[model samples]
Target: MSITLSIIYLISTITFVIGLKLLGHPETAKKGNSIAAFGMGLAIIGTIFLNNLEVPIFIYILIIVAILIGSVIGWLIAIKVEMTKMPELVSLFNGFGGASAALIGIVEYGNNQADITQVTTIIAAIIIGSITFSGSMIAWAKLNGSLKKDIRLPKYNLINNLLLIALIVFGFFIVNGSINGEIIIYILLLFSLIYGILFVIPIGGADMPVVISLLNSLTGIAAAITGILYDNMVMMVGGILVGSAGLILTFAMCKAMNRSLSNVIFGAFGGDSVAAKKGSTIGGHIKKTNPSDVAVLMNYADKVVIVPGYGLAVAQAQHVIHELEELLTKKGVEVSYAIHPVAGRMPGHMNVLLAESNVSYDKLIEMDDINPQFKNTDVVLVVGANDVVNPAAHNDPSSPIYGMPILEVEDARSIIINKRSMNPGYAGIQNELFFNQKTSMLFGDAKETLTKLVQELKNM
Candidate 1:
């Protein structure tokens, strides 16, 4: 029975590896998710029935019922959630993962405290999992607009550093048997949660992708710690995979934005800096154009690039924009989407949004690949994107996003930006691109404006 269970665990671990590899591309991501889920299901079955732990029938029934309820709720949420809310949904799910790991540590601590190794693992799990849970919840709130403003306490970085040191010292004392009280663990958990909230609440929404990824990595590390306590091979492997992948992605996102991990955590960027920018104004003449004029420009263009952003998702205009793409394609004009690494609220957000509307995968060119093409392009239609394409990234050293890499849309022959208004982007600074001689703004909801543009294109 032990051999059979080991074989099952091995197979499950293999599936996890395979699934994760398959997840690298958008085309196979769904398949990879299903494969990983199947592996997890296999692992659970092996643990429940194959393991010789004679559990009570009622406990088994309770587990099954809990699984059913959770699965139903998850399914409902996934189906009903709009594309615009996907980032918060992901943040919420990451929090649940952390909470689950922390719960396991709490429930198993007493049972495993006799062993020094188990005690260390449990303590580690509790700290990391607690922090991940609370931090991810705060991230979810910020992403979903439930927390509209960043709340920065006085000397927040100093406070956070002190709290972190305290957590480490407490954990070290507990591991060394200096703090033997059962209540001590609970104290650590409480402080860890507080630290998590403080860690995230000061960060502005612009930096949420990195935060989400970091929290996800923490959850994975916590899961691995719990797996060590339980001697679960499948769990350990899965956790490691998740932890490493999320960590790598976090660094990639930081690099894409031309920021460092330490800066992201301690800089508390896009909060106070952006708030100050809100009171300031950019001096320039705003050139405005209507759908007909923009449509005519696009119709006569040799090549056009479309840039999608958070506003495009909010307006639910992916389909309309896809229609516009198709219309231009039929008119002998080449159309492609220029996707910035951190374009939307989360990683790969723009790609997913366009994919939902059945946009060709090949047409969604990434930032580096498309930037040089902008010079040769006739028209660049920015659909509700602001920060990623803002010229401030290049010329304005005083701007918050000054050092970040941008879309370089200014290089195009003509730039037409669609937006509801001249409001600033997530960075809370005006886009200098809007005032450039070759750029014109089309003001309205993206969906309404795109629909009008498509109609105008058809007339042309």
Candidate 2:
């Protein structure tokens, strides 16, 4: 590597590492984000200056238009989207990444499939990217509530494996053969895309975090291949960092749920004999409460913690929740936001949503940080969250969600949940916490419920 390229790589790597570290802390998250963005900017500048790749004016024009469109849409989302809905938006962004990678592969094949050395990378990129794109889209749809939140597919282990094998066999011919048919690559790409969507379809909603993490890893692999194609050191490094981080997260998610990564990958969960023996045989009995009663409970509490979820996203109520937090803080009640790693549909879903509402990053506490505090918390206000706060994670071995690490919300002195109804979370399992004597279900739109609570506090 040239001196300049090496230096740039080192700088970019440092920024990403530090940025990720800061992001983990919550308190330093803003600075961490700035650092990461700056690092990306610097790398882009370096790429532009390398003076090697000749770009047509039209391509530059395309970049300009893309930037304009992206900036406008991003700004609108930043301005208008509720914190709860951020997870789905992230899924969409992930789709963009995966689709871009796949398209690059398609373009590359059209331009240079005659060469043998390039074929492998090209095929790999296409496979990884298409799958990521389609899978992420499905995940986004689920998180956004744009699609039905159900495990829509039955177990099909044999068929799924055969499809993969077929894809592999087709991939071998496409990569090894020269200059005959680009149609094969297209067919393979389409199959991979469909497979990606199907891959996540059988997964119960409760496993979204794991799905998102795995998809992230796929996108990283695609980026890395693209980097090799272009001989871009910074891109390669970034891809490696993202890929490794995603894998680690995937493992962590599996461990948190007391699940094996293999089980998650293979879609054999529902039929498991162990599932009957160990799953969370939770409740079909769900109860509902209102906001004013919840407010009274909150007013009496010495301390309160708010748990947010995908339901909150669908309602777009982060701002109102922020208002509730501010009210709690003024009344001398301690207020903190408990964030679950996979609470919504993606990683950092809650964080970005809260940030969009201008919620102080310091107020957000991670699952690890907040679990201990729950015991001392007078009330746990669960806003549209189900699976994460369900006691079934600990008590039910027969449940599909059995053994997953969940917030010990049941440990709190009292708990209040706001949701549409007794709807099962993405995992299709009942939340047992609603039956707890200390737990009260608050049924309404999350936004409306929180608004009523805010009003009740004012009346107090």
Count of backbone clashes for each model?
Answer: 0, 16
TM-score of each: 0.95, 0.82
The parts of candidate 1 lying over 4 Å away from their true place are 26-30, 273-281
Give the lowest summed-lDDT range of ten residues in model 1. 272-281
Candidate 1: tens digits of C-alpha lDDT, residues 144-167: 888978899999999999999999
Q: In lDDT terms, how accurate is model 1?
A: 0.89
Model 2 C-alpha RMSD to native: 4.0
Question: What is the per-residue lDDT of model 2 for residues 1-460, given as tens digits with 9 covering 90 to 100?
Answer: 4568668767987898888789777579899999998998777656555545678978778876886898799779777865555556666778889999999999898888766768778888888899999999898876555666445454566666778787777778887783248677789888999888778776655567688888888798899888888777767778878898889989987876678888887754543453454325444555566787888988999999999987887788989999999988999999999998777666577887888788898899999999999999999989888888877677766666777778899889988988888766666566768888888888889998889999999899
